[model samples]
Target: MNPIKLNLTGSPREIGIQHGRALYEQIRSQISIYESMFQYTSKISWSDVRDIAKEFKSPLQSLVPHIYSEMEGIAEGAELDIFDIVALNCRSEIALGRFSDGCTALSWKKSNNARVLSQNWDWTATVKNNLAMVSIEQIGKPTIYMVTEAGIVGKIGFNSAGVGTCLNAIRAKPMISSKLPIHVALRLCLESTSVGSAVKTLESLGGVASAQHILVSDSTQSLGLELSPVGNKYLTEDASGLIAHSNHFIENHYVEEPPWLSGSPIRLDRIRYLAHELIANGVSGDTITPGLLRERIFSDTYNAPQAICCKEDESRHISTRSSSLFNIVMNLNSEAPSAEVVFGRVGSGEEGPVLKMPWV
Candidate 1:
């Protein structure tokens, strides 16, 4: 089935109330899923997770109160505790590099000047039922069309302003609750008018809670921001105007210990190879489009189970098995900014229906 679709507008609180009322059951499912994931991955109970979530309350309210208000709305709308919503927003931070979610993301500026950003979001298949496609309309912020988990405020998607974002989770250390959470950072990017403005917002805030790599693209350009609590780094597109990142840190980072997720390097190399090959072909004559990328690059399963379009392995333990939950491709052209979200593994026969963005 396609993920639940929601169009939310009004004040932050009202929006949250609508979201909460509309997806109350899904939100509850999301909370239950995370409660188990936290215990299995981080060896922490849900109560402890809530306690960890409490640390970010003040920072969120002080730094980005609108989002905090929106989150509060979600909690109130769902008739759940605010901290429950906070825990969902802060899951990346609370997990502390213990969870396993492997994703491969890319941003390509085609010779035709079409800016494209996409990724295969890999995670445990259990959360699939709770996923959602959210379109948010607010007074000041750009209109947002994104694929997000039930309770989290921000995630992968593009805005009407022609700004788009893709996320690759990085599991590096020295998490600081005072900084913005990774998912919230993606929300801020969606709210931005330009890639430069998004970068400025993240930089000014002193980076995110933990480590994450966010690929930001607009009508003009695409760049990757590798954020960590200690410091942040910028990765510009190559001369070919292509930037690809997997779970691991691509550039030298703030710490000596590199983040580890099995098969990350292999998946990175595989996708890069396929992308360059497609670019070469495109240079000769083949036009590159979101459909082409989905079929060629993301559909690849060169190394079963651990491939770019990941699949769960029966041999692996239930807690460790991960698959590509969805694939999203955005064409960020000022003339017509659009997105295509596929709810399951791209080429995996059982992939879900395709959902196009901007509603109309």
Candidate 2:
């Protein structure tokens, strides 16, 4: 399916208004899905969603005014309350209160000295049709090209400054918080001009509301940041110049695991094994192109629904009836900064059409 594209510019509110108006229907659809999921999974009423969202309003406004403006614009355009938009942006934190097991991200330096980042966003099938690709151009910030659900401002993507990022949902004991949400943190990372700046941006947040793993890289370096409500830690590349993260923490001492992540350990082990095997079998950076990365590694259905490229299975205990929303592979070393996004899962021996961004 073709994803909606929103090319927005100007002040944060203006940009957000344009985004919300242009994708108003999609945003509405997303809200509906979230509402249903919250009801079914957490028994959370919309009233409570709004109330929880309100608690963060002051903090969000103080920490990121531009994002607040953008969210305000979204609310205005979508004809929804500002708190609704805030709730959507904080979906990770709220939803994690009930369920948490989705998303996978990896970053590695190519043998040719280039850097690449890849991720598979696995989520409830409800918003499958509500996804969009957004390009945000701000006056003094790095241009952001991200793939996100409607209404929510940020999820995954890279920037024009050669900095790229991918996100994975992680769980911590007592998951909810009142600090910066993961989605907002993601936008902050995309706004960063470099890897260091991105790390610093996250570090500056002091704390966040939920646990998340951010796989970030630039032309020069790659790192994985595990963020929690209490503290954060950095996970650097291993001796093989590769780092992969799933729904659970590999840096065990850094955080505690939520109970619903039984499949996380398997997924993490599979990715690490595959990555190392690829390198050991002579799949060097020169051979690890975007297509290969998607088809060979991310698409592996070794364990069915729990594989790197997940599929929905109703029988599984930890399944969310989720499928791959999209697989994004970015070449951070590209002169103009580019990415390849394949909507939906990459089936066995089936190569789907890959959409290249910033059309050459």
Best candidate, lDDT-wise?
A: 1
In candidate 1, clashing pairs total 0
Q: Which tens-of-lDDT digit does each residue in 29-140 have in candidate 2?
A: 8778778777877888877988888888988888888899899999998888998899899877877646544777788788444788898988876787898888999999
C-alpha RMSD (angstroms) for model 1: 1.5
* CA deviation > 4 Å runs, candidate 1: 111-113, 283-286
Give model 2's TM-score versus the native structure: 0.94
Error of 2 at 275 (Å): 1.6
Any residue pairs clashing in model 2, and if so which?
none
Query: For this target, which candidate reaches the highest TM-score against the unseen true structure?
Result: 1
**Candidate 1 structure quality by residue, lDDT tens digits, 322-353:** 89999999988777789888988887788877
Q: TM-score per candidate, in order?
A: 0.97, 0.94
